[model samples]
Target: MGQARSQAEPVRDDSLLEGTIWTPLGSASFPAEQPLRQGHPPRTEALPERTATRTSRRCLAAALEAEKQWARAALGAIGDAVLTIDLRGTVTYMNRVAETLTGWSQREAIGAPLSRVFPLVDGKTHRTVITPGRRAIEENRTAGFALDCVLVRQDGSKLAIEDSAAPIHDREGRVTGAVIVFHDATRSQVTLERMAYLAQHDPLTGLPNRALLTERLSRALGLAQRHRHLVALLYLDLDAFKPINDAFGHAVGDSLLQAVASRVQECMRVIDTVCRQGGDEFVILLAEIRRPEDATRVAAKLLAVLGRPYCIHGHQLLVTLSIGISLYPDDADDADALMHNADTAMYHAKRNGRNGHHCFTAEMNTRPLQRRRTEPGLHHTLQPSQLVLDF
Candidate 1:
């Protein structure tokens, strides 16, 4: 009777059997065969056709869901702000950084206009910076903004931002949307500006230094030549400056120098460039000089202004200036030569007497050759025989 029942009708299989599992879509078997436990379901081939199809579909749906979650995690992990816009410039997606940068949540930003979401402007001009997303999509390429771009956040605060946009292409090579990447640039921009300022200015007096003076002189020479004009350089030195520093403490002497710089600056036109050429000296470049005598007039005014008494640290002090003038194209063709000639004339003024001005002449260049003969270093190189003969 038991043999007849088993052969006559199909029954639930209680015994384990390993075989290929056939589903509606395709077949997938288990990794390995184990005993068919009594409470557990039978092998895959034992399942109904409809049930097999349902199980396969669920697995596919779960895989797609996991892939989407992974993509969202990747976008959130990026450091820079990121957003995506359609070809029509509508905001379609935003990462966590983008939401933070715009001060808008992802839900609030999606489906918004790109301009409304970004709200960028030129920091210097205060004019609206055109959104690069539309341009990138239209041109089917990438576009970027200058470092001066500023983004206005949702709360009305402004941030210095730099960004770029690239068009998204479909498999068919058609532009579909654009991706934008941006980050804060305020710190780097300020640091670069500060470094550039310190490079060209003096630490003590906040005036242009000699290196900057040379740069401006070259530019001024170009303009003067183009306009058929001449550039004049007035090199100035404080007469007996060392003795004053010796008489008083350096702190008081520094205050006196700072005061002198102010008065000297007050004696020039806005077109003039006054630069501090190290201790107790300054070089002034007068751009677009109509007459050589114009430099002489400016030098006289500066001497009068700088020679006034200065009260520093409650102590009265008196100082005088010696100025030497040289004209571009007349004194020398280049900036360095003009500076050297002016320096020579300043010493010539000192030799004649303190507190005066002198115009450079061709004979001033010969002073260096004369000085080399009497230079103190040359005395060190003299042989004992030469000294004995002199004795």
Candidate 2:
């Protein structure tokens, strides 16, 4: 060699670096450069290592792009709502479900403050609630909304929702943003409430059941004792329910019971509670009363309203109630004793005469024992075939 020529320098390819690419932090776009045309392929044997390295990088980029696309598709196809926010507390992404739930489109929500896009409030107090994403970012961990959290949408409508938020971190373990996932919880919340209502109420009449009545009675007694007020309990039994149930079957009997519950509720104040203690028996609670006469007036009004004819299933049915009254601290101090005394008084009203009311008395307690010992059985006195019901 006349003068040893320096090894030919390899030509660098700028097309690969110029292509647009996406990353979690950001993305960019650029016009694609056309490939160079040559008469023949260049010999790469001289620089096989450089050629292989470039080819590997191109394949890796293509794989990464495919994975990114797959992830985007998966997120968009999910049922639950998904949202992402940047480090500046601004919205960056919203899935289709998120758009539908928050009533905000991704185009309009992007770059907007997270609070403006996803507002929340307490379901009970209606107070503003912090977005879970904000909490996750501040705390650098996962967070979730409390039970009964409500989401206020863009159109002003509110939705009951459940959600969780987690901080999104980069490869270097630095928190770059936050992501939230949520779903509508309205149906589940309604189901829970309906179950609770059914547990404490009569399914037929939709009135408080025996358990609820007992609970309220105990509460009323506690408050009465503290406030020095009198609480009254009225025990009532249908005067002619058995014969009607036997004659018309349970359909008409159930309807009559519903009507009775409705009328009893109408006669009561908001403070009073009316409960169905199964079958044709009901109990009314007067949370507070000034005198025994107040209880008597309520009983009288109930008798008059209930005595009216009820048109059920084309049958004009007439019914009456035998109501017995008892007072807390006067008849008995405890709920059970008060209930027992009222029940005894109800039996007294039934015996002396049906369709009337009576106040509990200490002497009346002995009457039931005496009558049961001296008189014949009630079934022996009246037969099912001989029983005549008025309708």
Candidate 3:
């Protein structure tokens, strides 16, 4: 009977072990070896399955953390300021550049309306700039625009920026938000304005140079032709300038020339143009002249201005100009031809005597011998008929 009981006890324990909860280390009996009372079998509790579920949840949490890290790194790398706004123009996302440009951190910027964070104005008119986020939400279309604007920083300083905005869309092909990109353009814009100024002005005299002078002359010529009026061209050559340059050196000569240019400019009307045609020569364009006497009066004024002595570098330099006057249509048709005839008359003034003025005439072109005789210090023994003609 004892042997039979031992054998039955082993079978009963084996059955209990199979039905009870088991760990890797050991197995636990559910009833703790108590005498069998009712007809209920031992209950089994799940342990490994619960541990597997907890591990899976931990792995999923780690993956999400890694994705967030990557997204932050990418947002910080962009050079331009980037801002994302919702349909109502409320800020949703802001990159590092945006924070720096707007003088607000991401914590301060997000959830705030765009107008409250960064006010915008039109590039030209300084009025309120169009809101792309509101438009995108209202119209449900892809809207975009670019403009130059001033952004007020947190410290109350202003920054010049070029801003571009585009509508942000969702997976359903519906516009839901807006993304704005902006960058600094102050230095570039200033450089462009400086270049434009240099292109139109002379660096030396701070005056409009040949290119600007030609443009003005073209307009003046058109007006003169329309009104059937005469325009005068005055070609001026500095008399004995080479001697002054040789005696006082180039520095003093340049100073004297600048002084002479200033004096000549002061003598002219605002409607006239005075331009330096290289070294020791200048060209003047006088518009709306009614008679030849008007050109003579301007020529006399130029001579008086240039005839004065200039004190440069403690040296008194006496300089004078020989001016030649040529009337439009009487001398030639266009600017080039008129300039040429004026130059020819200047040579006549130089030959007659430096520091004088002469008007161009057709007779001067015909009588070559008389032109030669008019030169300064050219002695010719006059015959009886020539003496009578001169008287």
Top candidate on TM-score is 2
lDDT of 3 at 47: 51
Per-residue lDDT for 1-391 in model 2, tens only? 2123223344366364444342332112222374323543333344555555666988999999999888778999999899999888899898999999999999999999998999999999999998899899989999988878999999999999997999999889999999999998986678899999999999999999999999999999999999998999999998767667767779989999999999999999999999998889999999999899999999999999999888778777788789999999899999999999998888888888779999999998766543231124443454444433364
Which portions of model 1 show Cα errors greater than 4 Å?
1-154, 163-187, 367-391
User: What's the best-to-worst order under lDDT?
Assistant: 2, 1, 3
Clashes of each: 0, 0, 0
* CA displacement after TM-score superposition, residue 380 of candidate 2 (Å): 13
TM-scores for all candidates? 0.54, 0.59, 0.56
Q: How accurate is candidate 3 locally (lDDT)?
A: 0.74
Better of 1 and 2 by lDDT: 2
Q: Pick by lDDT: which candidate is best?
A: 2
RMSD of each: 11.9, 10.9, 15.1
| lDDT for each residue of candidate 1 in 310-373, tens digit (9 for 90 to 100) | 7677666777778888998998888889998898888777767658999999987766633221
